[model samples]
Target: MEERLQAVTTPVLLESSAAGFSPWGSILRAIPEAAGDVPALLALAVEAGETWPRPGEGRTSLLFELLASVAAIDVAAARVFEPHLDAIAILSQAARTDTADQPAAAGSAGGTSWGVFAAEAPGARLNARPEGAAAVLDGAKPWCSLAAGLDRAVVTAHTDDGGRAAFAVDLRHPGVRCEEPAWVARGLREIPSGTVHFDHVPALPLGGTGWYHSRPGFAWGGMGVAACWLGGAVGAARDFRAGLLAGADAGREPDQVALAALGEVDRILAAAMQYLARTATHIDDGSLAAAGQSTWSEAQRVRGTVAAAVERVLQLVLSNRGPGPLAFDERYAKRMADLGLYVRQHHGARDDAQLGRLTLKGDCPW
Candidate 1:
């Protein structure tokens, strides 16, 4: 596994750097060949834990690097097309039964944490709407990581039929447009997470009738997003460490504190990664209810951990540097902001309610 990660790291890194702040094209081209290695990225994420950021400036670096590899391999096609079909079939089949628990695996979808994270492309929820489908969409996806210049985007949309469905839309459709947003975000800025507009555009359906959220892949996708966020947090932690330890005269006391904090962060990330892996496996084994219940809680836990770690490191750095970090350093400031915003995606409180319903009420509502 180490050998595999090392072998691919250079190619992805070179491509990411050359591609610069707008490397979606390279990512798209790389996907078909590198899709199989996604699990490797997850393993790396788990191994790096929260300390991965010590080596880099923030989580965006590693996040984009991993995504670059995924795009290099083209996993999205399989994730969206094939698994979507399977998920729909399972959901439809399960719906026919008198009991909702007949086969809890109705929502399984392939693709590791990478696919899951990409699913949360900002405005995904909005794009997959009836109005968004029919009308001209003028809004932008603040951080659409792999969206720019892609051949196709499998986005969620509400169909004319009044049901939520994932649709495969051509990025170059006459009505479609992609541009970087003019606003500033805390991290992941290189993602081309700009705006995509559809002027009464044409699109193809991704799954069957009303099978969007009902499918199991949606939940799996959510878990995947949480995993990626965890990876970024780890990267940020690493960066913090490297910065603190770079100077020969750096104080040992702060290093000791950072190291201890890193250990706690590692524990939290490890638990989150395990939860994600177990959740994916449970879905595969026909245990959707168990997977869903656990996923909600895990997502929240991961976010809480990441937010806490980032904040802690930020505070420590501020105390040590005495306001140097606030001098508009894009990497540090943006990262802090991004991590803070990204944690909200974990659905922590919402997941708490979901877990309560699944565990205490003993029911799988979906």
Candidate 2:
């Protein structure tokens, strides 16, 4: 296991150098120009999944590598694809029910992508009820990514017993209705996130009510999102470095103030990376659970740290580069916008307060 981790980490470390960014850049460029191209992106994600880390073990290193790789090229694409990968990660730990009631594991219409629609917003009330030997899903699930493209989804709905449960729903079923895309934000606009309505759609419960949120893997999955955010931060920092190098090559000396800001950016990002590594190690050693620390608390801490680092990196780059990248560099601009939007998922001060409350319960492992 150590050998496998070293094999993965070595390449990531090697690629951290200026000369090594091209490999991942090439991979991103290889993606088709079509936005939200599920079939194309899914193919890439499936290829990446071949090397996905095993279940119930420490996957932080591999997941961080993946998110960083994909996000460096296109964070919007990462937003669209990560959920599918995360759904698979969640399914690995899910309580399996009768196989007779399970949907076929194959992709929908031969496409390889999947999605998770578990956000329980007040607008859509997806309900699950027992129908004979099976269960049926009804109502809408908002923030459903890859809705029109994916063949299946792990949807959360209110069960008849008034508790939340996760169900594997086949999007190909007649009762599953995908509303037209409504997202207009520039960031993650390429992702086909919209409302999916289930009209008595046949469902297979993956786990019992409340089990989806209770699993340790659930918190691990949240940490995966933070990893992606850190990757985006890296991408942004890389762009800043490239700009500085390009100026130097042209006999232009960087401003002293700008250089200082860049130094600070480096410190911020480096600290976040180190924190991520430590957190991953903790998860792997089982020290977090052993210490009676909730995975949710750890995830929140990591997310908060990464989100702040990304924000600082973005601010410093813009202040130093003076909007040149945002105005002239398409890739940099997209990464900036996408990361800004993605990190908003972190919930800022509210999450920090939650972490504070959780910490006060006992000795802080952090």
Candidate 3:
């Protein structure tokens, strides 16, 4: 497992360092202003979408590679890219569903970009009512990333039968309105995440009630997000390593303490990669199903592990390097903030409690 993990991640790191393969450089060049422009970031995402993993192309491998590459460059940019990839996956599944009357016009005219707005919060009621041939979505959906920028969205709303349903919404419609006062945070400001009000906006329902949540791929997608977190951790590790190397070159050799901290970072990251590789293989081989293990359980475990690993990496880097990276280096500062914000997407205590329940029930395979 260790060998396999190293094999998958090492090459990606080496290739990223090679000439003519600067994903981060390309992102900076494309969006030079970094003005938190949604449309511009979406455009950059669309252009780079081709480089992402395609269907049936070892999604696990590509996911790890992408997280490592993009996270190293800019985790906020990685945040943008992660949703695009997930939207593609969700839309593809929607396309395959028997409920899809016509083809899902995802990447059609007007350069449509997609986002998943499934975060459920009270006071923001996004309910779906069947009206003749289409579903009418009314009320507001909150925590919507790239709300203004996304041309289309896969939204989760309450159905008429008191069940949850997923729908494809066209944000360009007249009834749809994206609210202002986007997320105010230290990092990931580039993601224009806010509330979007739907005044009877027409939508296309995907699959039947509960299909979106019940699908195996749903858990797979969650693990993909974990991959992004792991990648961001790797990026942080790289910054620390670079700083140490520079210090060494300047005749300030890192003592045994600094060396030990670096070693610990490597150990944590290596363990994370090994876990990811094993999980990806299990997902690919349908091992979870065979073991009667729920994908949700597996996803939670992987997410929890990766999130803890990233936090540890950040703490160690700060302890060893002090506030220089965060204060002086703009890119490093952004990476740290972006990673801290992004990883919080995982519910901390609530998720841990759920995982404990799964373990008690003997549902966790690992």
| TM-scores for candidates 1 onward, in order | 0.53, 0.87, 0.87
- In the range 1-366, model 1's lDDT, one tens digit per residue, is 655333332223311354453433333343334333533333333233223221112233333334323322222322222222222233333342121122222112321121111233534433444443233232333344434433344455544566655554555566766665664644433332455666666544445546656554445444444444544455445445556665535554455666666566556545544544444445455554543455344334434544454455445545554456557654455555555555555555566666565556544334
Among the numbered candidates, top TM-score falls to 2
**Candidate 3 regions with alpha-carbon error over 4 angstroms:** 1-38, 54-57, 96-110
> Which candidate number would show the highest lDDT if scored against the true structure?
3
lDDT score at residue 301, model 3, on the 0-100 scale: 90
List per-candidate RMSD values in Å.
Answer: 12.6, 5.3, 5.4
Q: What local lDDT does model 3 show for residue 247?
A: 96
- For 1-366, candidate 3 gives per-residue lDDT tens digits of 644332223323322344434443355344424425556667776656546663223556545556556565567766776777777777777674332233334445435577888998878889999987679999998899877766677899999788998888888788999998546798887775788999979888887689899987788888878888888888788778878999999999999999999999999998988888777777767776789888889889999998999999989988888877778888778778888999998888899999999899999765
Steric clash pairs (candidate 2): none
Considering summed lDDT, which 10 consecutive residues are worst modelled in model 2? 6-15
lDDT of 2 by residue, 95-133 (tens): 453332344455543335567788867787889998876
Cα misplacement distance, residue 93 of candidate 2 (Å):
0.5
lDDT of 1 at 204: 45
**lDDT (CA) per prediction:** 0.42, 0.73, 0.75
